[model samples]
Target: MKDLELLLKNIKNKALLPVYFLHGGESYYIDIAVKSLENDVLTEDEKSFGQTVLYGKDTSIPEIISLAQQFPMFGELNLIIVKEAQDLKLGEDELKSLEFYVENPVPTTVLVFAHKHKKLDSRKKITKILTKNNWIFLSEPVKDYQLAKWIADECKANQIKTAPNISHLLADYLGNDLSRIANELGKLKMVMKEGQELDEKLVETHIGISKDFNVFELQKALGNKNHAAALRIAFFMGKSPKTNPFPMIIGNLYNYFSNIIIYHTMHGQSPQVMAAAMNVNPYFIKDFAESARFYPLKHATRIISLLREADLKNKGLGANQIDDAELLRELTYKILNVDRLKVSV
Candidate 1:
């Protein structure tokens, strides 16, 4: 699969290759590429000449091949796009039909396959088929640890540099969703000048996180078993729909406890060592170490389970009437007053 940066660069250079296949976990890059291709490569007049878009579930390979083989009426190239190509049947039964077109795709037409979701099993024969003859691109999602860097890089890509702390805040707020983070960053960058330092104040004004509140302090409050502080933060988060979601909050909490679990399992390990082991920034180690002292491994795990249940309930499964604030209050009580739940921590 080609790198998204390189693919966009090539497209800008008017060097698009035929039979391009884009598949992966990262939908943001794929979406951007598709829009770029549609807007820059083919004009409205060219689309009228010869442009076909089909879903894999709707069209047969033969029908797709036929359209691809058709010549452009009055354009440089005809475009044949197959969206959700992973849904297309690819097996021994359909092998002969697919092979015939793959063996001899039309030269004058540009065929693009937008295969979404996780990558197809590499051992599958069809995976090899696409790689052997076509231009393939994977839009995989960024991993959690790499997300902060991706956010910073994106800001730089837009020529808008962010303060270091704001990068971490955006990563925590956005979680693992690169597409949402990118969209939010686009809005943020619009209000910034080149070389402007995007600080927490700007983010709070535009994106709705409290200027002073952050994942670090949130974890610190949790570690010390500060029920009042935790509830206050949760209430503030609930009031700000733009910044609050149970999933992101739960995920950050999970990471925090995971660090605690690691710290407990290791004997006499320095905070620096534990932070490195947990893949957390060193500055956060002080709070995490203190948290480990207050919330033992078993207690932290129990609270994590409660958080997971609250997450599900809020999603319309377990309890319907439980609002975010009440749900958070319940979680806070359970975490700070673990013995009150009548369960051994």
Candidate 2:
């Protein structure tokens, strides 16, 4: 993100690069950077004659070179963007020629590649040259642990404050597909007052998440051994299978217990240290500490095993004909019973 931000900042300030290779697994950041460049690289009047889009499946490396060599018809600089560059069929000789172009690029043109889903070949000589010159911007996906913090940062950047752990709730409900998360937040932001802090109620009302009852709340209930609350949430989840998939629920439970197990091992660590280690907010440290007392390492391990069993059943691998709600109910019952043998650790 920093590299893309820096690159886009330079472009908006008219400090354009001779070559830009945006490549990697994450498409959201790549799309944002590409759009910014398309909008800022040339004026609306200049774009008619200066800007051109090329696709990799249709354009050869030789064709790209030909386009790059052309002088701008009515502008100061020509803008050439190659979308899906990986699909462009190129032999070793063509790759060598492409390398030569970037090495001695057209100063009157701004060349950009929108490579999505995968990165360029790191073993290739051209890739080495691009990396050495800091021309390739890698757009990596956000780690699972970092999604909530990222959402909070995104909200802050858009001038909206989020209530305590509200972003975490969003992250819990919205997995980690950043583009979808951003789109939902964008819609939520339209109705939100400027400087208004986004809260659970607002998210529930606007984004259709049941802020009062979700897998996140269910996790909390199980952690605290609030059997009634846990069962209630599980029943709700089972009733609305469309909104709550068994795999997603199992995933959340697995992560929750995984943290608890880690917490048990680090017996004397401070809240800040533990929070840092677990990649969660310090405010949530208290809950983890409290939950650890209820679910020791022994129980956490067993619950993880139970979640795996539930996962297999959900996948229809030698499981009964029971519905997801029944599986969840059984799993929750098993989890609540796990504490009875907590001294195994």
How many residue pairs collide in each prediction? 1, 0
Least accurate 10 contiguous residues by lDDT in model 2: 336-345
Question: What does candidate 1's lDDT look like per residue over 104-209, in tens digits?
Answer: 7777888888878867667756567777864667777787888887787888888877665667788888677777888888898888777678988888888877
Q: For this target, which candidate reaches the highest lDDT against the unseen true structure?
A: 2
Instruction: Please give the lDDT score at residue 83 for candidate 2.
Output: 90
Worst ten in a row by lDDT for model 1: 336-345
Instruction: For candidate 2, report its TM-score.
Output: 0.91
lDDT of 1: 0.75
**How would you encode candidate 2's per-residue C-alpha lDDT over 182-228 as one tens digit per residue?**
99989988999876878888988998888767888888899899999
